[model samples]
Target: MSEIERLDLLEKTLGRILVAIGAADAKVAQLFAISTGMLGFEATIIAEIHSFSCFTFLFLALSALPLLFSLFSLFMVLYPRLDGPESVIYFYKIARKDIDCYLKQVGGITNSELMDDYARQSHRNAEIASAKFAWLRKANMSLFFATIPWLIVVLIGYAAV
Candidate 1:
């Protein structure tokens, strides 16, 4: 594919990544809200658990692992956004005079080497972001699956009592 096409694809990919990040952020926010609400109902939960068998408490404790894992995953998802790829201005400032020379070589006088370097840098950032998203997805799944044990305990405990 042409360099332009590749760049276009990269840009599109970046856009999609941003959207995914936003959606993930929203979901995480919801999780936090729900978790916080649960906190408000903590007394009720504890009261319920108080009457249950030791097994119920054990399962309740086990449920925390997934919550922790999901939290770790949330941080992974935020890592890229928190410490984003170097900005063009930052690169320009760091590279100093090299930026001018790079710009001069643009258009018909394209500096293919410099272009490739920029592309490489973008690709690296994209890869990291994509990987983070993968972890975030896994974390989300973990968060979901974590509820199962808690539900099982609650149902069984209720039936037992």
Candidate 2:
């Protein structure tokens, strides 16, 4: 009805969207890890079934699928959105300002409690950002390291075959 109510609804909707994105990201990462691990097991099975030298290259190439996916996810996370860095900065600033305005309008009694609440909300936001950054960094590193050995395996397999 009011501008404040609309802003509050928008904030709530954004929060839900972010939560869904985060959940999807986690699920994707987990699936990738499981798939890669399964590929490693498959390679071991193939090595036991056939000569290690003969199939090594094929196995290596196969293992690269999950690694590539990890790199792709990392790129998605790191790529700047259409909104841009300035937009993100502005969004947070606006969010904090909105919260402050809401608190003042509500006529909170205690200064200490209001400050504490603000600090808690800020900390939560920081933690969310930190977690997202960490996930992206780890994914990138995993892909980078995995690629080298994967390439080596492909080369070795090709030479042997």
Candidate 3:
């Protein structure tokens, strides 16, 4: 395809990827908040229960450990996002600088070469971003499943007490 067409496609791809990243980041944040809040509440309940009975506290602690781990896994889920694909930003920065240089080149040349390079880098960055998100997505799913046992434990612990 022509440079202009390629650039257009690259821009669209970048936009879509950025949107996905934003959505996933928001979701991770939301789930983290919920998990932390629930964990906090459970800890408080266990503390209160402990005041009344050592046996109950021990039982609840046993049950709550997985939930705590689940929450830990949830925290782990954010690592990819925190690390994110630096290549994308790097490519964009390079492209911006190249673009400026291209504009200043002699004879008002429309540098299709740099545009091609930009397109290539953008495509590469998009791929890297996708792979990163795929891993993040898996981690998020694992976190979701992990919470199930925690919930069950919480319910059973409360019931037992």
Candidate 4:
């Protein structure tokens, strides 16, 4: 295949990866929302339980600990990290420059340079996606752990009322 064909394929691959990142981020956000709601529900239950017994506190701690950890993990997935120097293909960096400067830089780059940039950007984005998925896994694990205690909290809460 020609270099141009290779470049096109690389560009498409990079775009697909970017879209996957966005989808993963959306999933993490949804999980964060669910965990937050669970925490709020637990807090409300704890609040309503006016008779603060040791068992009440124990169960609340058990349920809330993993929930808080899940939230933290979810937040980590959303957190932005600025690693390495910006590339010509990095839209954020490109947009920061004056229009003339951006045009000049783009006009000056050869097809080979642009392809190199795309390859580098693709690798960087892949690394970012991997990190996000790892965080997502941690968040999922913690959320699952929280549900076990949460069910107990629900039982105790219903009995108290």
| Top candidate (TM-score) | 4
Candidate ranking (TM-score, best to worst): 4, 1, 3, 2
**Pairwise TM-score winner, candidates 1 and 4:** 4
Off by over 4 Å in 1: 1-26, 35-44, 81-110, 153-161
**lDDT tens readout by residue for model 3, 6-67:** 77777777677667656655666665666577677667655444334565555455545644
Q: What does candidate 4 score on TM?
A: 0.90
TM-score of each: 0.60, 0.39, 0.58, 0.90
Candidate order (lDDT): 4, 1, 3, 2
- The per-residue C-alpha lDDT of model 3 at residue 76 equals 54
**Cα lDDT for residue 68, model 2?**
62
Better of 1 and 3 by TM-score: 1
Task: Supply candidate 2's per-residue lDDT for 98.
Answer: 67
| Model 2 lDDT at residue 23 | 60
Model 2: per-residue lDDT, tens digit, 1-161?
76556545555655665574466466556546654764575454445443465456554655566576675665565443322122222355346556667556457535444344444444454455555566666665666556656656645545544
RMSD (Å) per prediction: 5.2, 10.5, 5.5, 1.7
Assess the local accuracy of residue 106 in candidate 4 as a C-alpha lDDT between 0 and 100.
87
Residue-level lDDT tens digits of model 4 in 89-161: 8877887889999889988999899889889888889898889889899999999988978978877887788
Better of 1 and 4 by lDDT: 4
In model 4, residue pairs whose N, Cα or C atoms come closer than 3 Å (at least 3 residues apart or on different chains), thus clashing, are none
Which model scores highest in lDDT?
4
